[model samples]
Target: MINTGKQAQLAQLKDSNAQLLKRLTARESRLNRIGMGIDAASQEAFEAFADGINGIAQGVEKTLRNERDAEAEKLTNEATAARRSSTHTSSDTAIADIMQDVKGCIEEQYLAAEKNLQVLASILGFFVDVDAVLAGCISVKDTQIFIRRSILAELSAFDCIFAAYNKIPNGSQIAVQTAHSRNGVPRDYVEDHYTQRTTKGGLLISEACIIHDEAHGMDHAPGIYTDEQISKWKTIVDAVHARGGLFFNQIIALGRVADPNFLDAQLKGPSNDVYRDREVKEMSVDDIHRFVQHFKQAAVNAMHGASFDGVEIHGANGYLIDQFIQKQTNKRTDEYSAETLKLPKEILDAVVQAIGASKTGVRMSPFSAWQGMRGDYDPVDQFEPWVRHIVSTYKDLAYVHFVDPLAGSSQEDFRKSDYLKKIVRDAGITVVSNSDLTLEMANERASKYGEAVAFGKLFISNPDLPARARNGWPLNEDYDRTSFYGGTEKGYTDYPFYK
Candidate 1:
């Protein structure tokens, strides 16, 4: 009589478990209905979706746990009865099947939720209206409520919320040109293209413009101190301005990397370390003063003569400025020590003073030791402090361009770009992301980080990169590596305009 009672209870538990599964299935259906016509594109939408998922996930887990407990009880009773009867009939397979189904269902739901989040993030990148949706959002919970309300309200103006919070102008979204040369100035190499009509006309299709001007220390390159160099740059600047494009002149001062043969007899850096064939001389106070003067003069030259929209201080990519910034090369006890940041501070101050704060920008490659500039300490520990210091000091500058950490050998696990952004977001300066970025990446990153994108090689082969990106046209990947530097019209001006 006891065995009969136990079997009857086990049967009731199975029936109850089946009803639970049916209810879970119905809950999933209801959740799906809630998600209908709801796509998360911005931070607001994403948070809303995450909140909904979390609540539903908790409910599902609770339901599954109850079902599992009842199932376990049924199995235990069956096993006890089997042992007493000495029949040794096994219901182990059926119990195992029930457990497996529950596990699979939970796993599937979690995976589906993850996939949905990814889809929403991608959609947010390409299609969200930033103005309408992102406006006046105070908190994550509030944002969630807004997303739900927006859907139910059928707000027609909701399209405004999807606009990327981009500070850059529309036509000049992609900058093809970069600071890759010291010997060849864009003005001299591509003279014909710098005419007012040609430039303005071409810029109608182009996005942002980065004029890779000469690094300051190289004698072969145009130095801002000279009248001749200023004249050439002026011509290009006026033309680009006429076209209504934002033109930035990249000015660099190669410190340790300055070739002794090409620059001073003995190259100067923060340390006395030997690089390649030359032993770098540590800069004295006098040297720092002289360098700062040159930087200031260069800014004065570029600003006064060419009327450039802005000047990008080339402080990255293993250049002289980078040597002073990195600990490996910058091991001095003076004010210019790796910890002090006095050298870059003075140089930046001089440049900013010469050119107003609104027209001065700084570019840094914190995660890159490119051109044999390996720092002695961890890149993160070394750069994080400096970023905080610089943002505090020069909060009003135009922008801070950081070469993407993913592009270099410094560190991959840490996103130095995002880290810097977190520190500088409230500082009121734009952060530009550069190094090996394509059109799709530019758009995605701009949407994700709310920053501008700088292109290097893509701009080299395709002059009309902005138009190509907009129209989804095929780009010319063919670029002559041999004729990249110090070349005539062969590789410079010879790249045909898009037909």
Candidate 2:
């Protein structure tokens, strides 16, 4: 009986243990279901959150797309209107069509500018002045010359040799002014004296070659205008004036501050050194002041005898004034520091004081690296300060001339031109824009900013550029590049007229 009772107790204990194991397994299965439900809910929440974010992003993108489309449509309408209103002849239209190969070139420039505007808007918002931000394009040497020649060709197509000051009798010889002496004591009855003589019939001055150096030397090749050559130039000036043409003085290559040897050491390249060394330094504030005074006197003299409206200092073409004003080239520790630096203020102040504010004008080449100039500074760093300085200091200047960077170069670095233009316009000055601008491009640029645009090469070939542009005539190509400098007629007088 005792053994049987012990076996029953053991069985009861085993059953109880089995029951506990089953309960534990059921609890674990319930806990797993609860965990799975929580995980599913979290994943669903995440998916919904991601979907909402994507929706908002899509809306913003649509809004931007709509805005861009509207802007593009507006631009397209303006461009179309410009094309339709242009009074081009059938032949001109044909030529323009042929020139369509260059349309992409033109459009590239336009698009680059548009993109720059977008970036500026994003950074500064739409409230900024677009005009002030879009200063006119910079002028290039090739483009300027092309425009100049084109204008000349169109205007003076009939003249075989359209010489401005063409003739002066025996202009090659020098003449002296002398006074008669009274005879007296046996020592010396007649007073004998001699002096260096001035050329008879005034000097024939054509293009003004403004040298930027310590000594203000004339850079025109020797035979172009000797004391003898002056007579012929004077005649040309007089004749042109008589014909209602205005004679202006352009200062060329007038910005060598230091001695050539010094510049050679600091700057690179032998060609640069040669030019710099040859440059007699006449670009200091004091020197520029004196030069302006001389110019004033010369202008008065020229006006007294011939037709003269006014005088313009050749502040363009990377001359001394431009070098000093630009930040990259002007590494001076003295008063003429970078535009951001305060030194230029004193130098500019002196210039303003010396040359009357009304008579003076400053020219800058922010993007141009002409004559080995490397404006390595940030474009804004280089331009903003300079523009600000000009605006604040020389408020009365006639105008500011900006030489736009070359087209190919600008394409390589699109931001350069835009940055420069923005700085200039923001400064609040009348800007004369120049570049390799075709007639259409020039007109578009001018229309955009209401600024005067100068076409160098076109001006050269078509002297009547203004009229040709107005009439929409086809421009004559420049045939002789060699005759561009120090030559008599091949490129200068050979182009024929449309009529």
Candidate 3:
């Protein structure tokens, strides 16, 4: 006569209604208290509220258990009555069918309640003090405590370490960087580099990505201008994709970093400053516009025709982009002066405009004095405005890669500025930390600071670095320093994978 399943559902509905009333009342109270300040609510009251919610859950479980018992008794009585009558088989079948239906009803009701609870959670999350709401409904704090305890109990507990490349795409937590493989490449050469790296034990994987070494738009270094170069890049991209790896092209304008004597054209820099014994002539606004277009064109070629997944604007290592970013190199009185980050910003914006910001990345070395790009002012103070602007403008970029000053200089004086780490982290962008990072240091920084560590020398030598780190295999220590800058296959792909 009385259906216990429907009764249980009624009881649950009533409980949900009461809980909603209590939650709303508590929210009002909490809101009023929060108006006074966060500390207005006593810890005891918070704990008591949490206990009350727990009690409500326990009461629900008890009520459900009692209803289930009643349903079992009712079914047994019906079967007994059927047995006493002449139609036992018919009655038993009817009771079994009803029981199945009741079970289905209960399950559906439970799912409905779960959905309602989720809706409540999402609503509560809108408030700043949802932690208080959560603490009431919140096993989250408890769960975190449990995790900490469990980690302490375990001998091998570790924090998450992300691979810099995967962090950008939000893929698997492993990455490899294209650092000093070769300065330039021909069509076949590019393909060979990708093939060697993306092979079974090589750096590139479906989970990993590759950043092609800087293409300075100079002689032999590779440029995205021509159809042949575009075709070659497409070949490399397809190869990497076939092997399950993404490829990114890094493009640069060398500025004073390029040798005047070596270049077919005149050397250009931000100011008419002599660098490396070469008299660097000042770049006109037209040159600046042309260079920005160069970056945009490179991005277009890379993403549009070349089939590359993304492009990282080379704004670091004292190149043209870096040259404009610092006061030391940029001496112009125009809008594109050292006081303005117009050049680097424009280059990044142009590239982002060419290939959407999601696929555009930029690398900067605010603290690096390499290639004579250091400014006269304190790096931290001098670069704050530019860093702030970058963070504000291109917040959603694929990543903002940084090369630490520590990579270049070991002087304690150079390490004093904390601005390098703070800049991108404050911007809340995906970061690729570069410059002489070892496997352990990379893991530590990636875990602690939420960064993706980019390895230069190590990735060059250890093709199976992720595997080596994962499996606790010893890394190859010796890499030919002589073959680091420019080389053939000997140092590039000849390094043996861990057996």
Candidate 4:
């Protein structure tokens, strides 16, 4: 009897356990289904909203263009009548009034467009996929057309069209010549594209002043340290700063230090093949010190003269410093070996020692593959050492901006967000995050991180992004794809603004 009771109890317990497991599995499946449904609904709603706004924008754009044409025709007719009548005395007053009216109309139109843009931007701000709408392979001109067609006129006046066009290259043509070869491009081309297009007013708060890589200018021969090159950079920085705009100063190339010899060899290599011709050679501590000294002096000079508001160390994008930090790249057997890699600390120390810690910022693409970068070892191992270095040595630096490796490319190599957040929090340093973030996403991340978030594309379209973001306004879509690199007025200055 006792054996039978024990067996029966055991059987009952097993059955109960099985039933519980089944119930739990069913609950989880239901939850997952609910989540998927929510996501699908959100996507549908966003698409609908975008389509509606775009339709309104197109109509408003058409109306404005027609109105402008009509006004121009009326003015032309009045001018012809004045010429035919030979009534100089009365005609002058009438003509002056007409001119004033035309000016008023232009101003009104500009205001209307600007207002509509802001409102549309605000609506789009609620959606998290603004990056798809704003960045990536799409052309700015196409984006502008999309915005003009989608958003309503009431919201059109709030767009960033005025801001976007102001940054386009104008007047200057891209001339290919030998004189500009010092900067890689022909002298005439440089003069045509850079000199003729840029203006003092335009330089102030222009979108290009923020998003374009500072290193693009460093492509000039003999590197950025040359007197002439440094002088030109100073002029550009000063001009932008004078206009109350922020200029990001590109510091030393981080990965180059891992093999300074390789850099030298590449620079000295055949003129036609520079970026990929030579293999990386080993670098010594002395080499790093020398490079740091040169960069420090340049930064100090720029800062002293109020050339830029701040300087960002190009520590990210698999550059010299990152190369050393990454295990696969830094195969040095000496004290700089992976086990005892102290190069990051040394580099940080040199920079912090030279530039005041408060004025310095470091950019890190912890998992980014830009510039042919591949973090060969486990990302955690590659990143932990650098994070440890940052906590210990450069704690007082302004902020650490991390370029999320998962962004802008199709790669699933790294997804350690939780780990990164924990480390950053423990380190207690201000962290600014970037990578595939839309305005809405950035704001959300900022809310969670309690620090600023950087937006490359939004900054490209909206010169006054900070202000627009704060006011819940719409942003103008970038319209000109071709002009983004080198062009003038058609895509640059033609975007109208709100009054």
Pairing residues by index, what is the TM-score of model 4?
Answer: 0.51
Per residue, candidate 2 scores C-alpha lDDT tens digits across 1-499 of 1223324433553443344335434533432332211134333432442333233334333433443454455456656766899743343343344335333433444345445444433332112222332222211110111011011111111111111211111111222211111110111100000000001111112334222222232222112212233334345455544333434333333345333331222322111234544533223445445544444444433333322222344444455555655654565555445443443344445444644454344455666677546546555566666677666766445456666777777464447665555555554444556667677766665545534465555555664555556677877656345555533434444445554
C-alpha local distance difference test of each model:
0.54, 0.39, 0.56, 0.45
Per-residue error (Å), model 4, residue 162: 18
Q: Write the per-residue lDDT of candidate 4 for residues 1-499, one digit (tens) a residue.
A: 1223324433553444344335434533432332211134433443443343343334334444544565566667777886899644454454455446544654454454334434444433221223332222321112321111111111111221111112224322223333333231112222222222222222111121111112222222222344444455556555443433344454555343223221223321101112455444455566556555655665664455435434566666666666666665666667766556465566566656766664566667766666655535666767776777676675556556677766554344435744664566455455656665666776665545444455554444454554566587777656456765454444433433422
What is the Cα root-mean-square deviation between model 3 and the actual structure?
11.5
- List the candidates ranked by lDDT, beginning with the highest: 3, 1, 4, 2
Model 1 stretches astray by more than 4 angstroms: 1-187, 192-219, 406-414
The list of candidate 4 runs beyond 4 A from truth reads 1-180, 183-248, 254-277, 284-286, 338-341, 408-415, 477-499
After TM-score superposition, the amount by which residue 4's alpha carbon in candidate 3 deviates from its true location, in angstroms, is 32
RMSD of each: 21.4, 31.4, 11.5, 23.0
* Highest-scoring model, lDDT: 3
lDDT for each residue of candidate 3 in 1-499, tens digit (9 for 90 to 100): 4556656655664565466457545644533332211122333333444444445455445545654675677668777887799455554565566557656555554454444444433322211223333334533221110010011001111221122221111111112223322223243543544554553212231111112222232323555666655776677778866764546677767887775432555777888988878787888888778777877887887788877766777777787878888887888888988887888878888888878775776777877767776745677765667667776887556666777767557565345434555666655555566666667776776555555555556655776665677788998879777765444555655678897
Worst lDDT run of 10 residues, candidate 1, spans 158-167
lDDT of 1 at 400: 74
lDDT of 2 at 416: 62
TM-score, cand. 2 = 0.47
- Model 3 residue 439 lDDT score: 70
Relative to the true structure, candidate 1 reaches a TM of: 0.59
Number of clashes found in candidate 4 = 54
